[model samples]
Target: MNPLYQIFVDPFVQMAGAPDLFAQTIWEGFVGGMLYALIALGYVLIFKASGVFNFAQGIMMVFAALTLVGLHEMGVHAYIALLLTLGVMYLLAVGVERAVLRPLVNQPDIILFMATFGLTYLLIGAGELVFGGNPKTMIAKELGLPSGGIDFNILGGLVSLQRIDIAAAVIASILVAGLAAFFQYTRVGRALRAVADDHQAALSVGISLNEIWVVVWFAAGVVALATGVMWGARSNVSFALQIVALKALPVLILGGFTSVPGAIVGGLVVGIGEKLGEFYWGPLLGGGIESWLAYVIALAFLLFRPHGLFGEKIIERI
Candidate 1:
């Protein structure tokens, strides 16, 4: 057996030999991919309304999780904490509208983007100051989420999948579907699409830019909350998971910035592609290649389709 043949071709043969591994990997990929798409949802909403790239979306996810956990530590019941977090998010939406969006209403787009970068630092500091900068275990039992595993037995071996992972996948599907329907069928959604095209034209039509901005950012906060919940269920809730939200940036790159459907599709592609590449080719690169593989795919997409899979081509006549 030639070493090159074994190194290069063996995995394909092995994949055919063990279909179960492939199935398991794809399942894991889909769940993780949906989580990434959830974060992308927040980015898309904010970008669509005000054209500000909300760099704080990930930190918002962290802040939401910290709000939930901090309430629990204060002896509040989980359900109450959950409801209170919703209220906090609403207040956050209002504050952002009054404090940030209002003053910067007519500023250049780059300035608005920088403002969000500042908001990111603000959220990080606030979350750490309130939550003590330590990882906290998700109160899965307290929340009454499922805590069982499903087992697949084949050839005298068992591979088990957690029920909570299944639940998270189901919830993500619902969120994505609901978001798509809103943007397609609802009045506010239509207004958001209008604003995404041209803020001045939207305003000319009597669309309230401030109102829409608040609504869109609140929608983003809801997405952040839902995402924090599911990811928290998987591991300890911490600020670190927010960095994983940053992974959604490449997803946004592959998907059009304003496309809900593209987020779903691009997230699945990145998730499954990275997992497959790492499993099959990681040893060749000394392993740990999955960390940067998503960016590699995004770079390839940039070279081929800078506007992304669903983005419209920008035609500038100079």
Candidate 2:
């Protein structure tokens, strides 16, 4: 077998020989991509309203998941723990607006960006202080998530689909749709759009910047919680999970920071690309290429598009 042929053609031949495996791989990638989209959506919400590229979103997801799981461990009911976690996130939004954004209003974008990094460190310290820096199991059974998976026979092979992954996909779809509806039709949504367009102009038109900031942060928090739950169900919730947020960097680059639809599409592209590349071509490179493949894909797209696939093109007037 030619080395190049083994690297390039063998994977496809294997895929062609086992259609079921290909389908399974695709499904796995799709689920992974949806999770990436969820995280990217959090970034979009914050960026749109405040022009702050929040670096703390990954921490927020872990923190939220930890809070819920911690509460349940302390003997609180699952649903009650969930409600309490939401309350915590809401309060956190209010606190951030008052303590961070309000004081830093009108500052340079770099300053605001730095503030989120500070916030990230603060959350990390606080979460560790409270939660003891331990990995906790997600209360999937308590939360009523489906366990086990369904198996299907295709192309003379068994393709097993995890019920939880299916649920994650469905929940992600619903959340994205819900957010779309909220942004398109609600008065607050219109104000949010205005704020995203121009903060000073939004204030001139009677939109309260403070209120908008709080709402945006709160919305991002809610997104973080949902992401946390889904992710925790898939694996143990730990500080290490915060690394997943880094995956969103390529996603944002691929989708553009401001477009929600771009997040979804970019995530799927990155997810599927990484999986296929890892499964097929990974061994040639001695494996473990999944970590960086998505970035390569994003960089490839960046060379051509610059702003991203769905990102708005900027026209500079001299």
Candidate 3:
């Protein structure tokens, strides 16, 4: 057997020999991609409204999860803790709008982007100070999320699917649908789109920038909380989960900065591509390829479609 054949042909042969494993791998990839899409959705919400590329979205997720767990640890009920967390996120939105966006209005986009970096650090410090630097188990049982998975026998092998993963997928789908509806039909959503298109024009029509900023940030925060809960249920809640933000970057790039549908499609591509690359071709390159394979997929797509799969094409006249 030649090295090329071993690298390319062997994995397919293995998959043919065991179809169950391939199905399992694909299921895992889809779940991972769905989680990544949740994070990307948060980014889309913030970017659509304020034009700020929120660097803190991942930290916000970690912070939201830590707050929920920490509150539970301090004798609060799970449902109560959840509500309190929502209140905290709302306050956070208010504070950010008053202290950050208000003062920085009319600044360059780069400055706003930098401000989110500062916000990231602030969230990290606050989360650590309040929750300590320890991993905490998510209160999945308390939250009524499914505990274990079901196994299926196929092609003389077994494929296991976690119920939580299914729930995550369903929930993500609902969130996406709900957001699309809100953006398409609601008055506030119309106002948000208007602001996204032209800030000065929106203001001239009596739209309050501060009010819109607070609303948009709060919406992003709600998304962060939902993402944190779903992700924490799959794994332990910790500051380290912030790394998902990096994985989601390729999804954002592949989808387009301002597109919700693009995020979902991009996430699925990155997720499935990363897993398949790691499973089939990773051994040829000595493994651990999943970490960077997504970027390769994003870069490949970008070479052909620079603005992303669903990004709005721009035209300029010089």
TM-score winner among the candidates? 2
Top of the candidates by lDDT: 2
Residue-level error in angstroms, candidate 3, position 108: 1.4
List model 2 lDDT by residue over 1-318, tens digit each: 799899768999999998988998898999999999999999999998899999999999999999999999999999999999999999999999999999998899899999999999999999999989989999999998998999998778999999999999999999999999999999999999999998889999899999989899988998999999999999989999999889988999999988999999998998888888988789889999999999999999999999999998988999
Q: TM-score-based ranking, best first?
A: 2, 3, 1
Q: Please write out the lDDT profile of model 1 over residues 138-173, one tens digit for every residue.
A: 877787789889999863456668898888888888
Candidate 3: where are CA atoms >4 Å away? none
Q: Model 2: which ten-residue window has the lowest total lDDT? A: 1-10
Give one digit per residue, the lDDT tens place, for model 3 in 90-180: 9999999999889999899999999999999999998888789999999988988887889988767899999999999998898889888
**TM-score for each predicted model, relative to the true structure:** 0.94, 0.98, 0.96
lDDT agreement with native, every candidate: 0.86, 0.93, 0.91
TM-score of 3: 0.96
Clashes of each: 0, 0, 0
Instruction: Please give the TM-score that candidate 2 achieves against the real structure.
Output: 0.98
Clashing pairs in 1: none
- Error (Å) of candidate 2 at residue 190 is 1.2
